[model samples]
Target chain A: MTADILLQAVIGGLLMGLIYALVAAGLSLIFGLMDVVNFAHGELLMVAMFATFSLWQLTGLDPLMVLPLVVVLMFALGVAIYHGLIARALTVQFNRGMVQIFVTFGLGIFIRGLAQFFYGGEFRSITGGMVANRTVQMAGIYVPLPQFAASLVCLGAFALLLVISRTEFGRALEATREDRDAVALIGINRDHIFAIGWGLGAATVGIAGVMLATFYYVSPNVGANFATIAYVTVALGGFGSLGGALVAGLLIGEIEALTALVLEPSLKQVGMFVVYLAVVLFRPRGLFGRL
Target chain B: MEAIPDNAITRRRRNELRCALAVLVVLAILPLPISDVYTQNLIILTLFYAGLSQAWNILGGTCGQISLGHAFYFGVGAYTSTMLFTHLGIPPTLGMFAGGAMGGLMALLIGWPCFRLSGHYYVIATFVVGEIGSLLFLNWDWIGGASGLYIPFHGESWINLQFRTAKLPWHYLFLTFAAATWLVAWLIDGSRWGFAWRAVRDDVVAARSLGVSVFRSKMAAAVISGFFTGLGGALYGQFVGYIDPDSMMTGSLSVLISLPAVLGGVGTLWGPVVGAAILIPVRELSSTFLGGSGRGVDLMLYGAMIVLVALARPQGLVSLLALVRGGRNARTA
Candidate 1:
């Protein structure tokens, strides 16, 4: 019975870890492309979740059906952000780094305000969706269908991201990351590549958001919690490393699950934080970070 | 960078000191006519943030360490004093310094490990550490946990730092606090440590190569910054007469403490004062009018202003003063 309970926790952790990986992947992609950490990344996730909620509420479509639309919407948002605020922030002659941090941070607060203005801070969940309130029992372990399906979809998104990384656009992105100025010399429009990278990053997170909306509660402040976790994952995996994000995400997931079992569930995040601090303190550049 | 003559630096410092004294004198009398509690409260808050932001500027601005987790120190100061006052029968006036000491010690503790990482890594680490702190505080039942600790009103007394009938005392108290922080900044501005810190901010590698101990410089800045921030937090707890994890240690509070310094101009002595003067008033007024129903219009406006300021004047609002004076070059005050 003890072994069964442990197996159940492991499976639950892995499933959640897959979704965490997708979220961190989006962050890692943008950071790798341009040394900018999107402080507003979580708000983008909140927007996607809210979009899913609104679409389902309006058209009676399941979250799965609305995934594509939400992805497109988020992609546009990502590009618009890059063009509107980030572009100007990059040109500042004084305090360039501080400018970028505050600009994105301010954007995040603005987005959160918009969410609260519209949604009224109430926690809303999609009820009666395809995966809601269902559980799959396999090999004497039980898993919620919403989480299981979300993990599967997140895994597929990871595969898609991997595939994209192997394409021509991917080569352009790699070259830009290597040297932004050098890429411009090679006939690549650095600005265009940056915008597309933001879009791709947004789209990946959008997929995760839509899946999470199937099970998780949605609210104005919901993104803050997830954003912290995403930051930890990225930092632990070593910033800008996709493979590192995957491994770190899974590791964090298992740690969280085990911590919950051993300690109080309310302190689950404490375990992940401790592990992150330990790893970063020893390595100084994270487990897999190059810079 | 060309080295300025010693007399010129000394003259600038003297001018700055005179200017600061003049401003304080004007501020001291400006509040006498206003007896309305609302406006008085606003002035006090503005002064409080001015002080808090100055503390943030010491490390974040001068030393070039952008800490998003200062709420930890702020919370530490608040909790330390409150617990001492409530549980041990200790007066908060003394407890305040104790809080400041703890805050500085905590900064050293956190800085010990965090100083190893730089750039985005350090920023995130501070942030996570803050969250860990608040979370732990939220669960620790000994300190009242999430229910929060409420200071029992022990009537009006300067020793206790509590007042019931008038807001005037708090205003002057906070004004003095703000001026004290400004004075410290002024002293640091003229000191060798000031040059060392700016060097670290501009380029750590070059600073180290120049025989400046980069780690010690950052750690020193952190201690001083955390100490003043903690002092401010103790004052805040006494003024509010209540303390909670959400109110004292949230991520938003951390952002609030740093925003003024960022907006006014990081590393500038006058930046926090000017930024807080503008930001705290606008924030308070907007929230009073628009945040009543919790629609978040106030938040939206505040966020928009930050974005606008950061994008339009990256050097800070202080530089705009230089522009108005038509100075070809602005000295780093």
Candidate 2:
């Protein structure tokens, strides 16, 4: 029975870890592309979730059906943010780093406020969605169908990202990441690449948001908690490394699950934090992060 | 590189001291005429945040380490003093010092490992550490847990730092606190340690090559910054008369502590005071007028202002003072 319970936790953790990997990938992509860490990355996820919720409410469509629309909307938002705020922030003469941090932070607060203004602070969940309240039995362990599907979708998204890396646009992105200024010498518009990078980052997170909306609760404050986890994942995975994000996400998810079983459920996050601190102290650059 | 003459530096320091003293005097008298509790409360909050922001500036601005987890120290300070008073029958006035010491200790502990990481890694580590702290506190039942601790009424007393019927006392107390922080900053501005800190902040590699101990410099700044922030937290706990994990240690509180310094002019002596002076009033008034309905209009306005200021005045609002002085003294007014 104990072995069964442990096995169940491991499966559950891996499923959740996949979703975390997707979220962290978006952040890692943006950071890798430009040394800018998007403080508002989670808010983008929140917006996507809300978009999915709103669409479902309006048209009676399944969250799966609304995923494409939400992804497109989030992509537009990501581009708009780059041109409207980040572009200007990058040009500031003094306190460039501080300015970038606050600009994105302020944008996040503004987004959260806007969400609260429109939707109040109540927690809303999709009640009768396609995967609602369903469980799959596998070898004496029960897995929630919604989470299982979300993990699969996230893995597929990761594959798509890998596929994109072989395309012309991906080459431009890699070259830009290598040396943004040098890429300009080769006729690559750095600004245009940055905007597209932001869009791609947002779209990836949007995919995760739509999947999460199928199972998770939707609220104005939901993003804050997930954002914290994403930060930990990114740092632990080594910032800007997609593979690092995946491995670290799974590790964190497993640690969290085991901690919940050994300690109280409320203290589950402590395990992940402790592990992150330990790893960071030993290897300052994280496991896979490049200098 | 031409070195600034000793007399010129001394003259600037003296001028700053005189201006600061004059401003304090004016503030000390300004609250006297306003008998209204609301305005007095606003002034008190502004002064309190001014002090807190100044404390944050020590490490965040002067030392060039951006910690998004200061709420950890604040919460630690609050919990330490509150627990001392409630369980051990100690007066908060003395307990506050203990809280400050604990705050410093915590900073050293956190900084020991975190100082190795630079830039975003360091920032995220601080943030995560803070979250860990708040979560742990929330679950721990010994110090009242999520329900929080309420200070019992012991009537009005200077020793206890509690006053039920007087806004005037709180205003003066906070003013004194803010003045103390400002005084400390002024002293640090000309000290040898200050120059070393600035060097480390500007470029660690260069500073190290120049024989400056980067790790020790950051640790020292962290200890001092944590001490003051924790002290401010203890005072805030007393003022509010209640303490909880959410109230004392949330991520938003950490951001709020840093915002004033960021907005006014990071690393400048007067930046926190000016930023708090403008920010607290706007925050209080907007929340009272627009946020009462909970429609989040006040938050929207607040966020928008931060974005606008950060974008428009990257050097901070204090630089505007330089601009107004004909732009002759641009870097440090």
Candidate 3:
């Protein structure tokens, strides 16, 4: 009986982990390429979730169907933010680190405030036809349909990212990551590449956001939880390592789920953080991360 | 080194003179005649944040260690000192140091492993410390778990630092701590260790080549910062006379500690002080004007301010002040 519960926890966690992978992958890309932490990444996700909530309420559109629109909107916003804000910041490298941090952190809080301002703190979600309240019964175990859809979305997003990065645009981003000056010297638009990287990063969160609304409550504080968890995911997977983020996300999800099953649910997050510590201490490079 | 430019130096000194006088005049007389309990409470809160942020600046603003888990020390200090006062009837004045010591020890223990990692990894380690501390506080039977520990409201004693009256004591005490922290920042600015810290901040490899033990230096910084922050925590708990894990150890508290330093112009002596001066008032205003969602509104406004600040004066108010002072072109090692 214990074994069965543990297996269920693992499976459930892995599914959630895949979604985390989607969230962190874009973050890793931006960090790897431009070295921008995008402290507002989770907020971006929150914004997307809010958007989905609005769209669902108005048009009764399925959150999944709205994913592409959210991605487009977020991508454009990311580009604008990079050009308007981040570009000005790169001028002085001296205090750039703190500047970036405070800038993004402030942006995050501001976004949350905006959500609270407009949304009025009510929890909203995109619950379409069968997926909203329906559960899938598999071998006497019940799994929410939204959870499964979220996982599929996670896998799809990851696959899409893998392809993009392996393609020309991705190669250019990798080149930019290696050295901005060299990339510029080779006549590549490094700034443009960085903007694209940010856009891509934001777009991924858009995808993650809409899916999150399908299964989870969307509110002003929605991103707060994701923000820390993403940090843990990115750290556990190693900074700037996409593959490591993918694996770490799943692992954390599994750990959180299993811990919740055995212990109190609130403590599951605490357990994930402990795992993050242990991973950082013992294997800072992460399981699949490149040195 | 270039020939000591006496004339230019004196001119810069004169520029700083006006600014310093203005600040001193404001600080000296502002507390007087403001017997309004609300203003006193705001002042006390401002100074509390100023002290915490200044202590945080020692490591984060200076070395760029980016500690998001600083509340670990704050929560620990608050809990420990409060526990001693409540359970053992020990005076909090002495118990505060005990809290600081425990916080310092934890920092060393945690920092030892974390300092080995770079950048975001270090941040995650700090976050974990905070969560673990929260977990311990919540689950442990002793010292009041999730329900929280309350310092005695009836105990009106200076030794225990408890008072039944208004916010005057808290205002004065926190202001003193803030002043002391600034004094320490000034001392650090001229110290050999300060030079080493700046070196480590600018270039670790070069500093390492000069025989500066990078790990030891960072660890020292973490401990120093943690110690004062723990003291701030203890004082905060005393003022409120209530301590809880969530209020003390969460990221919200972490943001409160770090924001002032960032807003004030990090890596400078007066950065946190300026941050507290500017940001806290805005927060209070937003809270009053906005209401119910005042906290949320403040966050949005604060965020917009940060983005604007980053875009325009990324170095913050102190750096801008330094520029206006016409200090010889800012130099970085």
Ranking by DockQ: 1, 2, 3
Per-residue accuracy of model 3 over A1-291 as CA lDDT, tens digit each? 487877778878987888888888878878777667888888898999889889888888777778899889989988887887777777765578777776777788888888888887777766674478778888887778888888898898888988998898888888888888999888899889888888888898888888888889888888877877888898888778888899889888988887898777657787888878887788876665556
Query: What CA RMSD would you report for each candidate?
Result: 1.9, 1.7, 3.3
Q: Name the regions of candidate 1 deviating beyond 4 angstroms.
A: B1-3, B327-333
lDDT of 2 by residue, A15-100 (tens): 99898889999999999998888999889989999999999998999888888899899889999999999999989999999999
**Would you list the C-alpha lDDT of every candidate in the order shown?**
0.92, 0.92, 0.81
In model 3, what are the clashing residue pairs, if there are any? A106-B303, A110-B300
lDDT of 2 by residue, B1-333 (tens): 998788999999999999998998999899888989998999999999999999999999999999999999998998899899988989999989888888999999999999999999999999999989999999989998899899887999988999998998899888988999899888989999999999999999999999999999999999999999998889999999999999899888989999999999999999999999999999999999999888888888898999999999999999899787766656466
Q: Given candidate 3, what's the lDDT at residue B89?
A: 77
Query: Who is ahead in lDDT, 2 or 3?
Result: 2
Off by over 4 Å in 2: B327-333
lDDT of 1 by residue, A1-291 (tens): 398888988998999999888899999999989988988889989999999999999999999999999999999999999999888888889999899889989999899999999999899999967888999988778999999999999889988988998999999999999899999887999999999999999998999999999999999888888889999999999988989999999998899888888888788999999999999999877888876
On DockQ, the candidate that comes out on top is 1
| DockQ, candidate no. 3 | 0.61
Q: What total of clashing residue pairs does each candidate reach? A: 0, 0, 2
Lowest summed lDDT across 10 adjacent residues in model 2 chain B is found at B324-333
lDDT of 1: 0.92
lDDT of 1 at B309: 99
